[model samples]
Structure formats: structure tokens, C-alpha cells
Target chain A: MRATTIHAPRDIRLSTVPDPTITAPTDAIVRVLAACICGSDLWPYRGENPIDEGVTIGHEAVGVVEEVGAEVTSFRAGDFVIVPFDHCDNTCPHCLAGVQSACDHLGFTTSGQAELTRVNQAEGSLVKTEGTIDDALLPSLLALSDVMATGWHAAVAAGVRQGGTAVVVGDGAVGLCGVIAAHELGAERIIAMSRHADRQALAREFGATEVVAERDDAGVAAVLELTGGVGADAVLECVGTDQAIRTAFEVARPGSTVGFVGVPHGVELPVRHMFRRNIGLAGGMAPVRRYLPDLLDRVLDGRIDPGRVFDLTLPLDEVAEGYRAMDERRAIKVLLRP
Target chain B: MRATTIHAPRDIRLSTVPDPTITAPTDAIVRVLAACICGSDLWPYRGENPIDEGVTIGHEAVGVVEEVGAEVTSFRAGDFVIVPFDHCDNTCPHCLAGVQSACDHLGFTTSGQAELTRVNQAEGSLVKTEGTIDDALLPSLLALSDVMATGWHAAVAAGVRQGGTAVVVGDGAVGLCGVIAAHELGAERIIAMSRHADRQALAREFGATEVVAERDDAGVAAVLELTGGVGADAVLECVGTDQAIRTAFEVARPGSTVGFVGVPHGVELPVRHMFRRNIGLAGGMAPVRRYLPDLLDRVLDGRIDPGRVFDLTLPLDEVAEGYRAMDERRAIKVLLRP
Candidate 1:
């Protein structure tokens, strides 16, 4: 089997690797059909996060269940499914509370971004589609594995409501998809902050009512102006940079919420400001497993096409090129077929 | 009229001052029956916040409406009322949303500590009691003016549910009252952090199930241990210090909320940790006007005695001593009578 491995900063490569087998009673072997690079992947790839040598790099995919361990009951051989990034035992207290991200027996399983990977807690982690998905819908369905669910979580965490104003603070695939989720949640106005013409256009197509071309304070100012100086009813912080987080605070009205989905990097909240303004903040790693079902339904119903975020696609063998394109900012997200 | 004026740090003086008159069309003059030293007042008295020359300091009071401006309809001469610390026009959009603290026409009306003060937006800011309150009920009704309402807001903002476990960080009057509020809100267990015997007893009397005599990390660990390592379902931060804020974050379970009502002194939120934990933070200055009616009813019916927080009482002429008692930490709160 071949997998994308990261040896050092900016050193991601597709290399031949040993295939994974069912190692636990609850584990299942999945033959990856498609996978993509997530914004979080950039953390280790850009050396912003500490990485172990030769570690597998991706956590987004849709696949077929090739084999299952003795304890796996809900899934069987050849079942088409979407695997959420985090594996969880569905019966945990946190899982029962709908916060699967904090599942008691949670674990991450990514075998070097390989064609075949092992999924732990298979019954709770994988959501099987009704039938074999159409080839044309695979990319979009594959997105439900992480990005789409993550974007949906951002909207849900922000308490986005019908007729509410939602401002998304990033132009990456997740941010763009957040625009879609906010719209689907009935946000009357969706504001996307983007400098790239392509991403900006896609955001508008995805239901962004306006686009602010500036960054940081200027971007926040633009959002406030659009909101008639009251700021956004909900601001989605999809980019975890300090500037983006600060903008999230600056562009939210008093008593409004800022849902942050981006993996925070050097983001410190000015607590005094947040407290005085009565701004609510809630977001972490998206509990993708919690949102995958509804998002998959939206994709299957043709109500959304989140795969449009994948401006570039390539064979699994060309995973290095895909990484390069995303690393150099040439692609918002890359889709790889095995 | 005699008023307590803080000309500088530790320089509080009780002296004759001009009587307050209607300053706005919506203003009403009140002859204060009681005014108390608040925990927030200690911030300026201790030189943490700069004191303006000749500034009138007290914000919490229950008084008799002595005069009303032409536009003041809800309040008139001889009406006994609880005046919220913040003067808000309850008709604004924000006020209608129950965030009167952030009212569009918000104003503050305290002259250092005064016997006679003018309340702006009197029609909305003053909650008149159903009838003249007996002397025994005066203190409890006055508690509704600030501390009790603040505690109630903390519980409400944190979304404390029936049978939920709550952790309150702070042992001030507001924090003690938060214990009562959480109990009234149906919280099954309330953990109050307090080392002082007086406060701990008060907290226990107010329904705190357990008292933790620790601060910061150790306090959080204790709370987590008490909850079987899952942390509290709701955390109320009644102290605005950095340590209190951090403890609130650490002791809240994923998907739970932290309601903070402390007048923030110096605090910073670890965005990365908060993001990863999915903890929700919501709070600000209490919208006392919003809760006064119900809280006052609770007081009038003898369901709660929030005024027990005032362990010491003094005549208005001894206003300086009242400040000294609170500043020396000999009293949780002090009541000054005119």
C-alpha cells in the first residue's frame, strides 16, 4: 500500500507503506475510495504542530469496509461508508450528550493517509450510506467525512438562526462550506472574508450575501458596516490565527456568539472584552460524527455540493503534488482518488 | 444631601453634597434607604481602578422615589423601588432581548455613595415594590438591586439545568448568592470555592452541596474529581481575576457552559484549550432590571434571604467605616443606612 507520510516540515511524500489489518475486536479495515487534505493537516505540514517521523497525514475519507473484527456488528464486508475523523464508542456519556468529539473511548486512526486504513470503534465512527454512491457524488459525499460536518458544526456552535447574520472569517474549504451550512440553517445574510477571487466567487455561489476583501481590523470593520454597525449575529472563526480570532471578537455584536472551528494557533481571547460585551464563545474540534448524517442527506438531495471546494483532484499516487498545490495556496482543497 | 465621595484611593469621606434633581426628562430622584459596598467597588478603592475625583461610588440601592421628571411614568413620588446599578431604557431592542445592561440608552447614575441619587431612564430602571416594604424586608429587596440579580444572571447565562452539577468560583457575596440562584434553578449539586468559614457557611446555607478550599488548578482538579472526572455541568465565575476565569474553564465539562458575572479586573482566556474542550462562555454585567421583579417576589415571599450577605450594618454617617470594613475583608458586604 502507498500512503502520504510526513518526515519533516514541508516534507510530505507518497511512499510505499505496509497495509493495515483489523487489530481490535471493534476495528474494521477500510479501503479508502477518496481522501482530501484538511485545514488541520496544514498544521503539521507547515511545522506549526509537532509531528512524529513518518506519520500518516489525512483524516477525511469515504471507503468500503473490506474486513471487520469480531465485535463489529453494524458494518459488514463491502459496505460503503463515510468515516468521521475521530473514532468514538457511541455509548459514552459524552457521545450520548451529542458531543462525540469528547467520547470517552475516543481515538484518532489515520494510517499515513493510505489506500487501506483501520477504523477503530467502527460501529460508532462509520455511517453507512443507503447504497453504493454514484461516482459523481463520491467527492461530495467524501466531504461529509470531515470538512462538511466541521462547517456545519461551526454554524451550529455559533447558534446560527433563520434570519440571522453570519460572518465567516476564512476562505478555506471549511470556511466556504460554513457559508453553505449557515445558509442552510437560514441565515439571512452570509458574509465571507476572502482575498482570492476564486474562493470569493465560490463563497457567493454557496450563499454568501457579501464578501469583505480586507483582513484583520479592516475585515471586521467591513462586517460591522454591513451589519449597520451592530456587527454579525454570529461570527464563525474558521481560521485559527490570532488575527482571525481577534476579528471574530471585533465583528460580533453584544450578546452575539463567535463559533470558532479552526484549530486555534496562538489565539488568546481578551477576556475582559468578551465578558463586557456578553459575547458567547464555543467551538473546538468539530464533532463531525454528530453532524455527518444531516450533511450527507443534504449532499444526497443535491441541496449542496461541498466538493466544489476541491479545486484540484489527482490520483492517490500524486498525493505529493496535491500537498504541494495546497501548501503553496494554489488550491483551497485537494481531492485524491485511490 | 449627604453622600459618600471617594476623592482618591482610601480617601472616602461622608459630607454634605447638593441634592440630586431630575437631570433628564426620564430621570427620577430617589432618597436612598440603604446602599451597600460592592465587591466591584473594592477594585477602585484598592487602586486597581482609578478613582475619579469626587466620584459617587455606590451602585446598589433601594430607595423611595422622591421626585419624577415629566416623562417618568412608571415611577413617582413615594414609590419604594429597587434601582438597578445600570440605568437602561427597557424599550430598546437589546433590552427587549433581556440584555438591559447593554441597553441602547444605557446610563450610570451614582455620585460616589449618595443619600439622594438620580436614576436615569427611571421608567425602566426602577422596579417598584407591590407595596411599602417593612424594615425587615428592606435588605433583601436591596439585594435584588445588584448582587442577587448578578448571581441569577450567572446561573441563567451558564444554562444550569435541573439536576446539573454547578461549580462556582469566588466566595464574595455575589458568588454566595450564585449558590442560591443555582439551587433555585434546580441544580442538584453546587460546589462553592471558599476558604473563609463565614462564606463557606453562607454558601452551605444557600445550598452549596460541597465547599472546596482551593484555588486554580487544585480547585479544578477537586471539582473534576467530585464529578467523577467529567467536570461540572455548569460553572459560575463570580470573580473576575485571571485565576478564577481559568478555573471556570478547567472545571467545565465539554458541552457545558461557564457563566461569568464578575466585573473583570484582569483575565485572559486560553483560546486553544477552550477551542479543544468545546466549553461555552457567556456572561457580563447583570441585567438587574430584567430579574428584579421575579427576584423581588422571591424575597417578598420569604423564599430566599439574599441580604444575609451583609454581615455588618452602619449609619449613613459611618459610610467611611462601611468602606473600611469591606476593604479590610472583615465583612463580605456592608450595609449603610440613611
Candidate 2:
């Protein structure tokens, strides 16, 4: 099986890896139909996230079950499914509360960008559709595996409600998906903070009622300008850096919340600041598996088109160029067909 | 009028100060019946929290209204009321959201321990009961002005649900009050984390079903041991120090919340830690004014007595001794009768 491997910073290579087999009683083998290069993957690509070295990478994919262990009764071979980022035993107390990312026996299988990947906890982790999916909609379905579900988590975690205004920080794939999520959640006003023309256009297409192309204090001023100087009712902190977190904090109205999903890096929030304003910050790794089912329904119903996040698509062998394009800001998100 | 003033760290003196008079359209002047020393006062008394020398020192009180400004409609002469810590307009968005501490026109009137104190935003900051008769209940009613309410905020912020388990991280007046609040919120089990025997006994009186004397790591371990290693459903962080905050975070179950109401000092929660566990942290300076209406009902009903927190009492002139007793740990809280 040919899979993308990260050996060093910016040293991604397409190499032959051993084919996956069901090793656990609850395991199932998935043949990747569509997989994505996530912004989080860039964390290591940029030498920021330390790795054990030469590991198969990627966590989001739409795949078909090629084989199932004897104990996996819920799924059979040839079942179309969405593979959520975390391998959670969906029966844990945390999973019961819709926080599968924190499942007591949680596992992360980082080999999604490959021809065949073995999935653990198959009964709880895999969500399958009854019929075959259209190739045109595969990119969006692939997004439901992680990015879109993550955006939905941001909106849900921020408590974005109907008729409320929301401020989205970051304009990358997840941020764009957040706009869609907020829109679906009935937020009357969705503002996207983006500096790029192309991303701004995509943000608008995905239901951003307003767009602020500013950064820092000026950017916060712009948010206040739109929110009657009180800030938004809910703020989606899609970028995990300190500056982005600060902006999220500043732009959230007093007594409102900031839902952050981006993997944090060097993020330190001054407790005093959040305390004085009665602000709430809730976000970590998104409970992607928990939200995948509902978000899939929304996508399949044609109510939202989160697949638009993939601006570039290529064959599996061109995966290196996909990384280069995203690193250089040439693509919002790249979809790979296996 | 007579008042307590802090001229330096550990230097508290009873001195003559100008009697307060109605100065704003929303103002009311009250002759204090009861004023309690707060744990937060020790911060400035110890010179840890910077303050201007000679400043009047007190923010929690219960008193009789002596006068009202021309525009003051809700309060008038002879009305008995509880004065919350923050002088809030109560008309801003945050106040409307029940967080008066974050009111747009927030003001703190630091003269509650005086014979007469002027209160701005009187209509919003004062909560009055119909008829006052028992002197025995006065101290308990005064507790509602701050400490007790702070504990209630911790319980409410942690979302203590009916039939849930709660762990209180502090056993001070606030922590003890949190036990009562959690009980009132219908928690099936309440754990009080305390080392002192007197506080533990008081915690039981206030509804703590269990007590843990361990601190730091051992305290957290004790909580897990009590909860079958799943952690409590709601953890109340009544202490502001980093160590106490850490215990609150550690004892909270995954997908549960930690409600903190202590004025934060040198506290920093690593985002990475909170993110991975799906733990939530909420609570700040308790919006005492917001909880007053309901808490007052509970107090008046004879269901709970939070005033037992004041183990010592002195006349206005002995206010200096009141601070001394609290500083020396001889008093859990002191009430000054001015």
C-alpha cells in the first residue's frame, strides 16, 4: 500500500507501507476513497509538532470497508463509511456525553492517507450510509470525517444559537466550515475574519454575512464595529495561536463564549482577563465522531456544501504537490483520490 | 461616619470618615446593619493586591436605606436590603445576561464597612426583603451579599444538575457555601475538600456528604477514589490559587465543568491540558446581584444559614481586631456591626 509518510519537516514522501489487517476483535479494514490534508497535519509539516519520525500521516477520510473482524457485527465488507479522527469506544461515559475525543480508551490511528487502514472500535467509530455516494460529493463527505465536524463542534461548543451573531477567527478549511456550521445552527449574523480575497469569497459563499479582512487590534475594532461595540454573541477561535486566541477573546461579548478547535500552539490565556469579562472558552480536540452522523445528514440533504473547502484535488501519487500547494497558500484544502 | 481604613499592609484602623450622601440619580445612602470581612480583603491587607492607602475597605453589607436620590424609585428610606459587591447599572447587555459583575457601567463602592455608605446603581445592586425581624438571620442575609453568592456561582457555573456529584475544592466560607449551593441544586453527593476539623464539621452542616483532608495530588486522588475513578460530575473551585485550580481541574470528570469564583491570583491553566480532556472552566467574581433574588428566597425560607461562616463579631470600632482575627486564622469570617 502506498501511503504518505512524514520523515522530517517538509520531508513528506509517497512510500510503500505494509497493508493493514484487522488486528483487534472490534477492528475493520478500510480502503480509502477520499482523504484530506488537514491544517493540523501542517503543524508537523512546518516542524512545529514533534513526531516520533517516519510515521504514516492523516486522520480524515471517507472509505469503504474491505474487511471486518469476526467480532465486528455492525459493519461488513463494501460498506461506505466516514472515518472520524479518533478511534473512540463510543460506549464510554465521555462518549455517552458526546465527547468521544476524550473517550477513556481513545486511540489515534494516523494512517488515513493510504490505500488501506485498519480501524479500531469499528462498531462505535464507523458511520456508514446505505447507498453508494456520488464522487462529486465525496470531498464534502470526507470533510465530515474531521474538518466540517470540527467546525460544527466549534459552533456547538460556543453555544451559537438562533438569531445570535457569531465571529469566526481564521479563514482556513475549518474556519470556512465553521461559517457553514454557524449558519446551519441558525446564527443570524455570521462574520468571517479573513485576509485573503479567495478565502473571503468562499466564506461569503458559505453564509458569512460579513467579512473582516483586518488583523489584531484593527481586526477587533472591525468586529466591534459590526456588533455595536459589544462584540459577537459567540466567537469561533479556529486558529490556536496566541494572537488568534487574543483576538477571539477580545471580540467575544462579555458573558459570551469562544469555541476553539485548532490544535493549540504556545497558547496561554490570562485567567484574569477571562474572569473579569465572564468569558467562556471551550474547545480542544473536536468530538468529530459524535457530530459526524448529524452533519452527514445535513450534507446529504444538500442544505450545506462543506466540500467546497477542497479547492484542489489530485491523484494519490501527487500528494507531495498537494502539501506544497497548501504550504504555499495555493490551496485551501487538498483532496486526494485513492 | 466611622469606617475601617487600611493605611498599609497589616495596618487597619478605625477612623472617622465623611458620611455618604446620595450623589447620583440612581444613588441611595444606607446605614449599615451588618458588614462582613471578605477573603479578598486579605489580598490588599497583605499588600498583595495594590490599593490606595486610607481607602474605605468593604464591599459586602446588609443595611437600612437612610436616603434615596430624587430619581431612585425602587429603594427608599427604611427599606432593608443586601448590597452586592459590584455597583452595576444592571441595564447593559452583560447585566441583562445575568452577569452584573461585567456590567458596562461597573463600579465598586468600597465603603460598606462604614456607618453610612452611598450606593450607586441602587436599583440594580440592592435586593430588599419584605419584612425584617430576626437579628439572628441578619448575618446570614449579609453572607448572601458576596461569599455565599460566590459559592452559588461556582455551583451554577459548574452546571451542578439534579442527582449529580459535586466536589468543592475550598473549605472557606465560599467553599462551605458551595456545598450548600450544590445541595440546593439537588446534587446527590457533595464532597468537601478541607483539612481543618471545624471546617469539615461546618461543611457537613452545609450539606457536604463527604470530606477529604488531602491536598494537591493526594486530594485529586482521593476524589477519584471516592467517585470510582471517574471524577465528580461538577467540581467547584472556590480557591483562586493555581494549586487549588489544578485540583478542581483534575477532579472534574471528562465532559464535566469546573466552576471557580475566587479572585484569581497567579493562576494559569495550560490550554493543552484542558483541551485534551474536554474539561470546562467557568466562574469569576460572582455576579452576586444576579443570584440575590433567588438566594434571598432560600435564606428567608429557613432552609440554609450561610452566616455561620462569621465565627467572630465586633463593633465598628473593633474592626481592626476583626481583620487581625481573620489574618491570624482565628476567624473563618468576621462580621463588623457598625
Candidate 3:
């Protein structure tokens, strides 16, 4: 099997790796149909996050089940499935509570951007697609595994409701998907905060009613100005940067919750400010598995076109260029065909 | 008129002051029937909070409307009312959203422990009781002004639901009221964390099914054990100390919200832990006015006896003793009568 391996900063290559096999009773093997480079993957590729040399990368994909262990009941060989970023037993207390990311038997999907990957807790983690797979639906289905579900989590956590206003911070793939989620949730007003023209255009296409190109205090001022100085009813902090977190809280109305999904880095929560303003903070690493089934339905129904986020596509062997394109901001997201 | 004046730390005295008169059309003057010394009142008495000499101190009371400004329509002379700590227009964006504490025209009650106090936003801040007020209900009515309402805010913010588990951190008057709130909100199991035996008894009486006397790690461990290591479905943080905040988050189940009402002092939010665990932090200064009508009805119906928290009573002239009792923790709360 061939997999994308990371050796050092900006060093990504498609290399031959041992084929995956079901190692546990609950495990299953998946042959990747499509995967993509995530903004987070750029962390190590850009020398920002430390790397372990020669490790297979990627945690998002849609694929067909190749083989299943004895205990796997939900999926069978040749069954189309969306592989969520995290694998959970689904019956654990946390999973039952819809927080699958914190499941007791939590495990991350392994070797996702490869010809074959091992999936643990297959019965509880795999969401089988109905009927035969459609080539056009692969990107949207793959999105349900992580980005789209994550974006949906932010909207849910933020308490976005019908006729309410939603403020989305960050124009990344997840943030763009958040615009879709907020719209699907019936937000009457969706404000996308971005400085880039192309991303802003995509945000508008995803149902952003307004866009603020400013950052920092100016950004908060702009959002407030747009919302009649009352702030947004629901705020999605899709970027983990300190400024993004601060602005998310600042632009939230009193009693509103900021649903944050970004992996935080060097961010100090403004506890006093949050308290004084009666603002709330919710969300974390998204429980993607919890949202997969519903999101898959939305995708199949053609209600949302989240696949539009993939501005570039590449063959699996050209994975290095995909990383370069995303890192250099040449592509919003790069879909890889295996 | 006579008012409780604070000259410095440990200096509370009944001093003559100019009688309160309506200075604004939105103001109402009330003759104090009952006023209670709060845990927050102790902050300045213990010198934890800086104080200016000779300022009237006290923010919770139940009184009879002595006079009302021309524009005050909801409140009139001879009406008995619960004077919440903060006065709000109740028509602002924040107030309309049930966050009266952050109302656009927010104001704090003044000279509440005095013979006569002035309340701003009177029409919106005062909740009139049905018929003539009974002496017995005075204490409970006063509790709605702050402590009881605050406790209810915590429960409400924590999203306490039917048959769910609720953990309350802090066994003060507010926390005891939180136990009542959790019970009223239909939580099947209520856990009150307290080290004081008297408070524990009050907690149990107020509907705490379990009591954990541990602090710090032991406290978190005990709560985790109580919930089969799943943590509580809802957590109320009634104490503003760092440890109390930490324990509140530690005992919250994944995806559960911690409703915090304590006036935080030197507390650093655990953003990383909160994000990783998918725990949410909500609530702040209690919008007592928003909960006033509902809580007041509960008090009148005898469905809740939040006033039971006031274990000691004192005459208006003995305001210093009331403060002293509360400062030394000799009383759960001290109620003062004029």
C-alpha cells in the first residue's frame, strides 16, 4: 500500500507501506477513495507543529470497507463509509451523550491518506452510505467525516437557532462549512469574518449574509456595527488563534455562547470579560461521529454543497503538491483521489 | 434616614443620612422591611475588596414602596417589592434576552440596608408580591433579590434538566439556593460540596441528595465517584475562588455546562482543559430581575423556602453585628430588619 508520509517540515512523499489488516475484533480495513489536506496538517508541514519522521498523515477520508473483524457488525466488505476523524465505541457514556470525541475507548483514524487504513471500533464508528457511491458526492461525503461535522458542532454548541444571527470567525474550510451549518440551522443572518477576497466570496456562496474584512478591535467594531451594536446571537470561533478567540467573544451578544472548534494555541481565555458580559464558551475537538449520519443525509439530499470547499484536486501520488498548495494558500482545500 | 455605612475594613455602622428621594422619573424609594448580609458583602468587610469611607453598603432587600417617581408605572406607594441587587430597564437587548444584569441602562440598588433606599429602573426591577406580604415570607422574598435568584441563575445557566445529575460547588447561601434550584429544575440527583456541617444540613434540606465534604482533588474524585466516573450532568459554581471554579469544571460531564455566578477574583479559566473535555462555562452576575417573577411565585406558593438560608436575624441598628456574623461564618446568612 502507498501512503503519504511526513519526514520533516514541507517534506511529504507518497511511499510504500505495509497493507492494513483488521488487527482487533472490532477493527476493519478501509481502502481510501478520497482524502484531503487539512489546515491542521499544515502545522507540521509548515514546521509549526513538531513531527515524528516517516509517520503516515491525514485523518479525514471516505472509503469502501475492505475487510472486517469478527465483532464488526455495522459494516461489511465493499460497503461505502465515511471515516470520522476519531473512532469511538459509540455506546460509552460520553458517546451516548453525543460527545463521541471524548469516548472512553477513543482512537484516532490511522493512515487515512493511503490506499488502505485500519479503523478501530468499526461497528460504532463507521457510517455506511446508502446505495452505490456517486463520484460527484465523494468530496461532500468525505467532509462529513470531519470538517463539515466540526462546523456543525460549532453551530450546535453556539446555540444558533432559526431567525438568529451567527458570526463565523475564520474563513478556513471548517469555517466555510460553519456558514453552511448556520444556514441549515436557520440563521437569518450569517456574518463571515475574513480578509481574503476569494475566501470571502466562498463564504458568501455558503450563505454568509455579511462579511467583515477587518481584524482585531476593528473587526469587533465592524461586527458590532453590523449587528446594531448588540453583537451576534451565536458566534463560531473556527480559528484557535488568540485574536480570533478574543474577537469571537467580543462580538457575541450577552447570553450568547461562543462555540470554538479550533485547536487552541497560546490563547488565554478572557474569564473576567466573559463573566462581566455574561458570555459563554462551548465546543472543543468536534464529536464528528455524532454528526456524521445527519450530515451525510444533508449531503445526499443536495441541501448543502460543502464539497465546493475543495478548490483543488490531485492524484494520491501527488500528495506533496497538495500540501504545498494548501500551505501556500493557493487552495482552500485539496481533495486527493486514490 | 439611617443607612449602614462602611468606614473601612470591619467598620459597619448605622449612620444618619439624607432621606432618599426620587431623583429620576425611573426611580422609586422603598422603606426597608428586610435586608440580608451577603457573602459578597463580606468581601469589603474583610478588606478583600477596597472600600471608600462612609459609603452606604448593601444591595439586597425586600421593602414597601414608599414613593415612586412620576414615570414609574409598575410600582406605586404601599406596594411590597423585592429589590434585586441590580436595576435594569428590562427592555434593552440584553434584558430582553433574559440577561438583565447586562441591561443597556443597568444600575445597582443604592442604600438597600438603610431605612429608605432608592431603586432605579423601578418599574422594570421591582417584582410586586400578591396581596399583603406576610412577615414570614419577608425573608424568602428578600432571598429572591440576590442569593436565591443567583442560585437559580446558576442552575438555569448550567442547563439543569429533568432526571439529570447536578453538582453544586460552594455551600454558601447561594449554593444552598442552588440545591433548591436544581431540585426545582427536576434534577433527580443533587450533590452539594461543602465542609460545614450546618451548611450540609441546609443543603440536604434544600434537596441535595448527596454531600461531598472534600476539597480540591478529593472533591473532584468524590463527585466523579458519585456519578460512576462520568461527572455531573450540570455543575453550579457558587464560590468565585480558583479552587471552586477548578472543581466545578473537573466534575462536569463531557458536554455539560458549568453555570458560574461567583464574582471571580484572581481566577484563571482552564481553557485547555475545558476545550479537551468539551465542557462549557456559562453564567455570570445573576439577572435576578429576569428570574424574579418565577422565583417570587415559588416563594409565594411555598414550593421553595430559599429564606431558610438566613439562620440569624438582627435589628437594623445591629448591622455591624450582622456583617461580623457573616464575616466569621458564624451564620449562613444574616437577615436585618428595620
Candidate 4:
């Protein structure tokens, strides 16, 4: 089997590895149909995160079950499914409370960008589609595995309400999906902050009522202006940079919350400022498994088209090019066909 | 008129000051019946918060309306009212959203410990008690002006629900009031963190089901063990120090929010840990005016007794001793009578 592996900074390659097999009673062997690179993956690829040489990469995918252990009762061979990035036993106390990201038996699904991947907690982590799905919907269905669900989590965490205004702080795939989530959640006005013309246009298509192309202080000013000088009702922080996090809080109203999903990097939370303004900070590593059912339904019903975030696509063999394109900002998100 | 003024740290004096008169169209002058020393007030008395010499200090009081400006429609002379610590125009956007503390025209009520106090935004900040009967209820009504309301804000912000478990950090008047708040909100179990024997007893009487006298790491371990190692469903942070804030988060379970109402000092938020654990932080200065109606009703109906926190009572001229008693931890809270 061939899979994506990371060796060092900017050193991504499609290498030949032994085929994965079900090693646990609750595990399942899956044949991946589609997978995508996340903005978080750029951390190690850009040397921002320390790397363990020759580690399996990629954690988002849609696949078909090929084999399942005796204990896996929810899925069977040939079943089409979306694999949540963080696998968990759904019966745990945290999972039951809708915080599957903090599940007691939590595990990450690595090597997902491969021909064959072994998934633990199969019965709990995999959400299956009703029947044979159309090939054109693969990208959207695959999005439910992580990005789309993460965006939904940000909106929920921010308490985006009907007729309220929401500000999305990044223009990446997850941020774009956040625009959709806010819209679906009945946000009357969705503001997307993006400096790129292409990303801004996509943001508009994804239901952003306005686009702010400014950065830092100017960006905060633009959002405040759009919200009648009161700041937004809810803010979705999709980028974890210090500047992005700072801007997100600055543009939130007195009692609004900032829901952050991006893996924080050198981010120092403004505790005093948050305290004085009565602003709150919520959201974290998204509990994608918890949002899978509702988001999958939205995708199947065509209520949201998150697949448009895939501006570039590549064959699994061109995995290095995919990583390069994303790292260099040439693609919003790159979809890979196995 | 005589008022409590700060000459310097530990230098409290009841000195003659000009009588308060209606200055704004929305202002009202009130004759103080009762005022209490707050934990936050001790910050300035203990030389922690920088002091402005000769400034009037207290901000919590229940009084009889002595006079009202021409435009004051909701209050009149001889009416008994609870003056919230912060005064605001009720029609402001933030106030309309139930966040009066962040009102566009927000103002603080000073000189509250004096014989007479001028309260701005009379129509908005004064909640008049209907035909007040007994002086015995004065302390409870005064508590509603700040500490009790602040504690209620913490419980509301932390999303306390029926059948949930709540943990309160701090054992001062505000934290003791928080135990009452959690119980009123239907929390099945309330844990109080305190080291002082007197305060622990008061907390238990106020509705704390369990008391943990441990501090720092030991406190976190005890709270974790209490909730089957999952932590509390909601945590109320009534103390503003870094250690108190840290302990509040440490005892909160995943997806639970830590509601903080203390005036934060030297506090650094655990952003990475919060992000990884999916814990949230919310609440700030209490919008007591917004809660005045319900809390006032509760007090009048004998459903709550928040005034029990005031264990020491003194004549208005003894304000200096009242400050010393609280500063020396001799009293949980001090009630000053005019």
C-alpha cells in the first residue's frame, strides 16, 4: 500500500508501506476514496511543529469499509463512510456530553491519505451514507469527515443565533465552511475576513453578506462598521495565529463569544480585556464526530456545498505537489483521489 | 453629609463632604440605609489596586430615595431602592441585551457609604422595593446591590443546569453567595473551596454539599476525585487571583464553562490547556440591574437569604473599623448602618 509520509520540513512523499490490518476487536480496514490536506498539517510540513521522521500523515477521509473485526457492529464490508479525524468510543462520559474530542478512548486516524487505512473504534467514529452515493458528491461527503464539522462546532460554540451577525476570522477551507454553518444556523449577516480576491468571492458564495479585506486594526474597524459600531454578535476564529486571535476578540461585541478551532500557535489570550468587556472564549479541537450526523444530512440534502473549497485536486501519487500547493497558498484546499 | 473616604492605604476616614444633589435629569439622591464592605474594596485598602487619595469608596447600598431630578420617572422621594454598583441607561444596546455593565453610558456609583448618595440613571439603575416593611431585610436587599447579583451572574454564565454539579472557588461573601446561586439554579451538588473554618461553615449553610479546604494542586485533585475524575459540570470563579482562576479551570470538565466575576488581577489564561480540553471561560462584572427584579423578588419572598454573609454590623462612623475587620479576615463581610 502507498501512503503519505513526512520526513522533515517541506519533505512530503508518497511512500510504499505495508498494508494496514485490523489489529483490535473494534477496528476496521478501510479503502479510502478521497482525502484532503488540512491547514493544521502545514505545521510540521513548514517545520513549525517538531516532526518524528517517517510518520504517517493526513487524518481526514471518506472511504469504503473492506473488513471489520467481530466487535464492529455498526459497519460492514463495502459500506461507504466518513471517518472523523479524532476517533472515539461514543459511549464515554465526555462523548455522551457531546464533547467527543475529549473522549476517554480518543485516538487519531493517521495514514488516512493511503490506499488502505485501519480505523479503531469503528462503530463509534464512522458515519455511513444510506446507499451508493454519487461520485460528484465525494468532496462534500469527505468534508463532513473534518473541516465542515469543525466549522459547525465553531458556530455552535460561538452561540451564533438566528438573525444575529457572525464574523469569520480566516479564509481557509474551515473558515469558508463556517460561513455556511452560520448561514444554516440562521445568521442574518455573515462577514468573512479575507485579503485574497478569490477567497473573498468564495466566501460571498458561501453566504457571507460582506467581506473585509483589511488586516489587524483595520479589519476590526471594518467589522465594527459593518455591525453598526457594536462589533459582531458571534465570532468564529478559524486561524490560530496571535494576530488572528487578537483581531477576533477586538471585533466581538460586549457579550459575544469567540469560538476558536485552529490549533493555537503562540497565542496569548487577553484575559483582562475579555474580563472587562464581558467577552468569552470557547471552542477548541472540534468534536467532529459529534457533528457528523447533522452535517452529513445537510450535505446529502444539498443545503450546503462545502466541496467548493477544493480549488485543486490531485492523484494520490502527486501527494507532494498537493502539499506544496497548499503550503505555498496556491490552493485553498487540495483533494486527493486514492 | 459624612462619607467614607480613603486618604491612603489603610487610612479610611469618615469625613464631612458636600451633600449629594440631583445633578443630571436622570439622577436621584438616596439616603443610605445600609452599605457593605466588599472583597474588591479591600484591594484598594490593602494597597493592591492603586488608590486615588480622598476618593469616596463604597459602591453597594440599599437606601431611601430622598430626591429625584425632573426627568426621573421611575423613582421618587421616600421610595426604598437597591442601587446597583454600576449605573446605566436601560435603553442602550448592551443593556437591552441584558449586559447593563457594558452599557454605552455606563457609570459607577460612588459615595454609597455616605449619608446621602447620588445615583445616575435613576430610572434604570434603581429597583424600588414595593412598600418596604422591616429593617431586618435591609442587609439582604443590600446584598442584591452587588455580591449576590455577582454570584448569580457567575452561575448563569457557567450554564448551570438541573441535575448538574457545580464547583465554586473562593470563600468570601461572593463565593458564599455563589453556593446559594448554584442551589437556586437547581444544581444537584455544590462544592465549595475554602480554607477558613468560619467561611467553610457559612458555605455549608449556604448550600455547599461538600467542602474542599485544599489549595493549588491538592484542591484540583480533590475536586477531580469528587466528580469521579471528570471534574464539575460548571465552575464559578469568585476570586480574581491567578491561583483561583487556575483552580477554577482545573476543576471544570470538558465542554463546561468557568464563569468568572472577580475583578481579575495578574491572571494569565491557560489558553493551550483550555483549547485542548474544550473548556470555556465566560462572565465578568455582573449586570446587577438586569437581575434586580428576580433577585429582589426572591429576597422579598424569603426564598433566599444572601445577607447572612454580613456577620458584622457597625455604625456609619465606624466605617474605618469595618474596613479593618474585613482586611484582617475577621469578618466575611461588614454591614455599615447610617
Number of the candidate with higher TM-score, 2 or 3 = 2
TM-score of 3: 0.97
Q: Candidate 1 chain A — worst ten consecutive residues by lDDT sum?
A: A105-114
What tens-digit string does per-residue lDDT give for candidate 2 at B112-170? 88888888888888888887648999989999989989999999989999999999999
Docking class of 4: medium
Indicate the worst ten consecutive residues by lDDT in candidate 3 chain B: B129-138
Local accuracy of candidate 4 as per-residue lDDT tens digits, A83-125: 9999888999999999999999888889888888888889888
Per-residue accuracy of model 4 over B1-338 as CA lDDT, tens digit each: 99999988999999998898878898989999999889999999989999999999899988899999989987789999999999988998899988899988788879988899988898888998777549899989999999999999999999999989999999999999999999999999999999999999988988899999999999999999999999999999999999999999999999999999999989988898899889999999999999999998999899999999999999999999999999889999999998
CA deviation > 4 Å runs, candidate 4: none
Which of the two, 2 or 4, has more DockQ?
4
> lDDT tens string, model 1, A1-338?
88889999888888888888878899999999999888788888889999999888888888899999999999999999888888888888788777888888887758626798888889888899876679999889888888888888899989899999999999999999899999999999999999999999999999999999998778877888888877888989898888888889899887888898888888777677787678888878888788888888888899999989989998988888888899889999999987
Pairs with backbone N, CA or C atoms under 3 Å apart (clashes), candidate 2:
none
Q: lDDT per prediction?
A: 0.87, 0.89, 0.93, 0.93
The 10 consecutive residues of candidate 4 chain A with the worst lDDT sum are A112-121
**Interface RMSD values for the candidates, listed in order?**
1.2, 1.1, 0.6, 0.7
Where's the lowest-lDDT run of ten residues in candidate 2 chain B? B277-286
Docking class of 1: medium
TM of each candidate vs. truth:
0.96, 0.98, 0.97, 0.97
